[model samples]
Each structure stands twice: as C-alpha cells, then as structure tokens.
Target: MDYERQPYRRCGRSGLLLPAVSLGLWHNFGEGKPVDSQRAILHKAFELGITHFDIADRYGPPIGAAESAFGRIFPRSLRDEVVITTKGSNPMWDGPYGKGNSRKHLLATLDRSLTRLGLDYVDIFYLHREDAGTPLEEQVATLDHMVRTGRALYAGVSNFSPEHTAEAARLLRDLGTPLLVHQPPYSLLDRRIEGSLLGVLEQEGVGCVVYSPLAQGLLTDRYLGGIPAGSRAAEGRFLTPDRVTPEVLAFVRSLAELASARGQTVAQLALAWALRDPRITSVLVGASSPEQLEANVGAVDGLEFTDEELAAIDRAAKEAGVEA
Candidate 1:
C-alpha cells in the first residue's frame, strides 16, 4: 500500500507516466467472481499505486459484465486518480455493428462502454483487435473522433501485428492523436513480441503494455508441480490441463529453480524478465485474490537480472520452444 513502492514509466513520447505494473480485468472481477472479491483486489491495486486498470467490452463471461462491475466498485470521485482503459471492436452483442473496427461499431461501443463504466471519459480507449474487413483509416478516424469528442483521452490498439501496428501508428499520428500504447502478449513462455513487434513499437514511439506476462499462469510456481484444483488450467478455456504436458513441466521446474536461487517466485521472475525490455511500458497482470496481487506487485523489487541469469533464462525458454 506504499505509494512510493510502484514506479512510473513514461508512455512512449507521450506525457503520460503509467505505473510499471498495471492490473487487467481480463479474468476475475466478472460475473462468476464475487463482488466483494473484486472490490478487495481493486482496492488493493490502487492502494499499491497500480493506477492502470485494463478491461474490455467482451472480457466478462457474459459480455459487458466486467466494466459494469468496475463501475459499481470504483467511485466517481477517485476516477481521476487512476488510468482506466476499456477496449471495444470485439463482439459484445448481436448486431450488424456489434463488432469490427468500423466507425459505426467503434463509436457505438464507446458510448456503451462509457455508460457501463459510469464515466464521461476513459483514460484510454482501444480497438480490441484488427479487422481485415475494415480499413485502418476508418478505425483510426473513429478513435480520433473519440478523443476529439472527449469520450476518451487517448487511443490505443490491442492484438495487432507489427505490420498492422505500424500502419495504425502512421494513421493515428497523421490524425494528430498518436497511438498511445499497444497491448500485446509477452511472457517467459511467449516471446513473440521480441521478434519484430517490440522493434516496431519503438520505431513508432508507441509504448507497449504487455498482457499475459505470466503466460496465463504458465510462468508461475502454480504449475511447477501440477494443475491444482480451481487453477486456470483446470477451469479456464484459454489454458487447459492438456496444454501442460510433461515437457512443459520439466521446463517449468528448471525455471522455478532459477527463480528460487534468486529468492523469488517464478511469477516474479517472469514479470521481471518481461520488464527487462525497455520498450515495455507496463506488464498487465490479472489476479483472483488480493494476496496474489500483492505478490505480483512485489516483483518490481527483484527486477535486476545478471547477464548470466538472463542467458540461463533464454536457454530454458528456448528449450521449451517458446521463443519467437
């Protein structure tokens, strides 16, 4: 709960300085989770100076539930103290303009998001994904309009490839509302961003807020032994028990050993590894409990890595065939 414990990093060339580690409502804080649990995690996050909270229109089990829950737990007076980012462009309902990067869909979703979040303007509004059917120009223009109309303070894109991100960055820059951040998946078990996306973001001066930094809990001590009861691998659709094969367990054990030598957990080591890249503005992590959130935020303390440790990490990750 110490404010000075979390450090802030500049978002690209923008004036915004976001916390080194951000929280995402991608999992938990939804329909299935209790309201009291969601409130506790969110309250603890803010108390720890984790000012950025990420969410999407389609994040909840039943779409729009996450933002609605946040609206209930987050007081209007303290809204200015935190950075709220809600994404659209993902299908949330049945309609012609329910999904896509089209101007109509984007604007309609923004209005719905605002109403659900109980806010006049969000800190950042992102187009959740790339739509091959829609032109990039239409998408950027719509996001530009959101900022111009005071519906969103900044615009961003998520799950876009390096090529798409480059094009979108150019378009948004031309529109005078430069792309603020790109939310991508980058973790010890997934280093695809290092191949080219990281370079692209750096060249364009667009900050990156990486998601799944713990590889959906793969790069954690939780799976070192096996999938425990109620773990994401056992219950979540994204990560399944079958995905955690013997080979993965071996790699996880090695990584956990390395983390132990450093007096940290695998989750902390994974987060620290992701932060090693300067291009990464923040690592967006999700938590089901307040204790988990606190442990993750403590990762900032052991962020320093020796050259030998970095090399060992790369070797282990490469052996797992997870490198980009």
Candidate 2:
C-alpha cells in the first residue's frame, strides 16, 4: 500500500499529523467474529496508510473481548508504526467506579484497558465522556499525571459540550497541560457540534476526530433502496428502521444524486464533507468488513468538494431536517 495516496492532516496546531481517515474497531473487531478478521483489518488499515486506530474499553459486544483480541493479534513490532487510541471511563458492568470521570476511575480503567491491549502505553488516551458529578479538575489532573508518568502520551476528551470543553481546556492549560482533542458526534445528520464546539476547537487549538460522520449509515447508500442483510441498520442497536422514514429516504435519494453528480458515493461525499474543516484532525469510521474499510479509505481521494457541492448537500440535508 502506498501511504502517499492517503493524505495526512495536522492535528489542530499540534506537531502530530494523523491520517485523515482513521480505522475504528467500534463495531466488528470485537466478539463473535473470526479473530483473524480483526487482525486482517488492522493489518490492512496500516498497510493502507491508516496510521491511527481507535478503540474503547467497552468496545466488544461482551465488553473487554475486543481488547483481549487485540492483545492476542497485534504484533509488538507493528505497535510503534501506528497510533493506538482507546477511551476509558465507561464501565463494563455495574459498579460505582466502573464508570465516571473521577481521577480514580480514569486512571484505573486506562490501566485495565492497557493490560487488555498488552501495551506499555497508548498513543492517545481519551476520557470517553465528562462526568457532571466528578470535578473537571480531577479529570484533567489525572490525565496530566498519565502523560507525566508516560502511561499515556497525550490525553483527550469525548462527548463533551462546548462549555465543558472550554472549562476542561482552561483547567488543563492552568496545569501546563493542554487537552489534545475532543471526540464529538458529528455527521450530516448531527451538526450540533458546528454551533460552538467547532469554534471552541479553533480557539483552543484542540484537535477533533469526529465519530459517526455517516450518522450510523443514514448518510450511506446502504438504506437508499432498503436495508440489506448484515447492514448496520438491520444488525446493530444504533440504527433502526424507524429512522428510515419516507422523508428520510427522500432526502437520502437526493443526497445520493448530489453525490453521483460529483462522481462520488454518498459515503465518500459524507466523509469528505467532514474533512472540509481544518480543525478536524480525522474522521473515525467503523467498518464491518475489509471491503467496507477499502471503500471508506477511498473517500480520502474523493475529498475535493466544491463550495457549490457543499451548498447543495446542505439544502438537501435541511429538507430532511438533518444538520449538514
């Protein structure tokens, strides 16, 4: 694989430059699949210049199974060639400290996640989400400590509101440690982040690798005609038929038409639109198969969107009440 074919973008104002498209093992690289499949995807992604891979503590269907699989499959020599990012703070099961943004939970969960990943340190460790109950100070302090101790190279936060993001940045900056990135729900369907989160990231120099840029396949061509077998809408908990109303299909067709006019697929258009922003460091995508991974990475080549194309996409998305 020619890495030069996949464009790389600087992560905000940071010195780090990550591949524009990142491979996320949030869906199929977990339990209930051939372990070889997970290894294949990771190897394939790296070969395709997808230098960054995203995972989480509770990523597996049965929880921790994904990490265990990664531990078994990923080779130690290939580890330094990639940037491994995994989130903590989510509990695998019911427990007090099992879930929270408290310093104790973040530190403990990351330690467990590392053991499962079988690595001395993760490239980027995310806080998963903010805990209203736990003080932001504690969260930032613990993350800084991880960086200081070399348990984690850099720390980031996900699923945080713009206001909370600002607060966290302020807290970390005061401690002489700046937040690395913010993972937010972003896509043609979810534009809420465009309101202020994008603005905050610009002002704070915080990189953003938005997830679900396809709105869980809503923005894909998969549901344009109907939900196919093994489609996420049919097999996953996140997307449902209730989401594919007549109005949505109508919008989908129009969007697909718009994408075709540009000589790109809906998935390519959707992912490309996201990379439009300079602040966006990467688009974390979940692939159910290697074919899907190849198609998703091809999106990087189709990322040259004109202003007119963006305007048309916005109008079409607005008709369905989707944020573009």
Q: How many steric clashes does model 1 contain? A: 0
Q: Cα lDDT for residue 220, model 1?
A: 86
Cα lDDT of model 2 by residue, 58-113, tens digit = 98878887777878888788877788888887875567877888887888888888
Clashes of each: 0, 0
Model 1 misses residue 236 by how many Å?
4.1
Q: What is candidate 1's lDDT per residue for 247-310, written digit by digit as tens?
A: 6777788888999999899899889888987888999999999999999998898889999999
What's the TM-score of each model vs. the native?
0.97, 0.96
Top of the candidates by TM-score: 1
* Angstrom error at residue 238, model 1: 1.4
Error (Å) of candidate 2 at residue 253 is 0.9
Residue pairs in candidate 2 whose N, alpha carbon or C atoms collide under 3 angstroms: none
